[model samples]
Target: MANPTFWVAVALFIFIGLLYYYGVPGNVGKQLDSRGKRIADELAEAKRLREDAEKLLKEFEAKRAAAEREAAEIVSNAKEEAERLASEAQEKMADFVKRRTASAEAKIAQAEAQASAEVRAAAVDAAIKASESVLRQEITGNAASSLVSQGLNDVRAKLQ
Candidate 1:
């Protein structure tokens, strides 16, 4: 009954009972409930932010895919256009070559005709000169004397 430990325990019991009678425990329970609700709200907000970030990433991915598709189409169209232009150029070049060949052939034919005409005229002149030279060689001294005597007899008859 005289121990100091016994007195301290009795004082602690009195303090605990007074605290319960005044509804202090109920106040502590209310504070704890409010703290738990705040923590739950913060966790829910964090989940919502994470979901928004995932949606944004998906949207960016879709945009990137569309851009890649568009680029492929443009490249395909460019290649097709280049091929068409090359084909058109080839046809035009072939036509130009054909026209040039025909023109050259026509020129060669005309030149050949002109050269043949010139050769034929030169052959005719050479033949005429050869015939004149042959005739001079055949008429000799006897043919010259007979022409002179015939002319003198004709003059004497006219005088008689």
Candidate 2:
């Protein structure tokens, strides 16, 4: 009635009042709260996933360390076994050499005894031949035969 501008301002205020009276502000607040809650839930899920990943990494590290320790133990056992086998082989070789050396020495001693016995037999045969020759040169037939018998008896008694 007085100014049209004043009427437009009043109509704008009435429109704002109607929006507030119909619960639009409360609906907007509820939507904002739901969005915040959803964001918080997603953040919590992300934290749980990160923690699970860390736990898996630690487990893998522990398994790797155990595997390395087991491998080292296996290598050590193999080395000890190899060393024992080598030591046993050395001992066996030494024993075999000692036995062979003893056997060789016994064989050498037996050969020496056989040679000594043959030499003694040859010397006895030669002495008998020389004694017979001397006896034949000094005596004739019947006297030589009688002296030969007595010398043979004396030689046999002395040898026994």
Candidate 3:
């Protein structure tokens, strides 16, 4: 009963009993539970945010695909238009060339006809002069003049 160790042990037991009576363990347990609940809520919020991000990613991907398709369609239409225009231009050029060639040929034919007429007129004039000179040399006086005139008249009528 007089030992110092025995008195120290008794004091420790009394301190433990006071703490229990005041509900300190219960308060610690409540705080731990609240902390755990807070951690769970934060985890749940993080998962929801991740799900929203994935949804947004999928939506953006879909939009990108649609835009690509539209762009391809535009390019295809442009190519077709360019080809059509090229063909039309070629056709127009061919038509123009044909028309020009035909016009040139017609002009050449007209020039040839005019040249032929001029040459024939010149030859007739030369033949008439030669005949007149020969007839004057071969024939004599009044009878010769009358015969020459008649022959000249006949040649002029026939040639014209």
Better of 2 and 3 by TM-score: 3
RMSD in Å for model 3 = 4.3
Candidate 3 lDDT tens digits, 1-160: 7999999999999988888999888888999999999999999999999999999999999999999999999999999999999999999999999999999999999999989878877887788889988999999899998999899888878886
Clashes of each: 0, 0, 0
lDDT of each: 0.79, 0.89, 0.92
lDDT of 2 by residue, 1-160 (tens): 6899999999999998998999888889999999999999999999999999999999999999999999999999999999999999999999999999999999999999988878876777678778878878878799788989799678856753
Q: Clash pairs of candidate 1?
A: none
List candidate 1 stretches off by more than 4 Å.
1-35, 124-160
Q: For residues 62-156, what per-residue lDDT tens digits would candidate 1 score against the true structure?
A: 99999999999999999999999999999999999999999999889988888876776565445444644554465557774565446445543
What TM-score would every model get versus the actual structure? 0.56, 0.61, 0.67
What is the full ranking by TM-score, best candidate first? Answer: 3, 2, 1
Would you give me the overall lDDT of model 1? 0.79
The stretch of ten residues in a row with the least summed lDDT in candidate 1 is: 151-160
Error of 3 at 32 (Å): 3.7
- Check candidate 3 and list the clashing pairs: none
Q: Rank the candidates by lDDT, best first.
A: 3, 2, 1
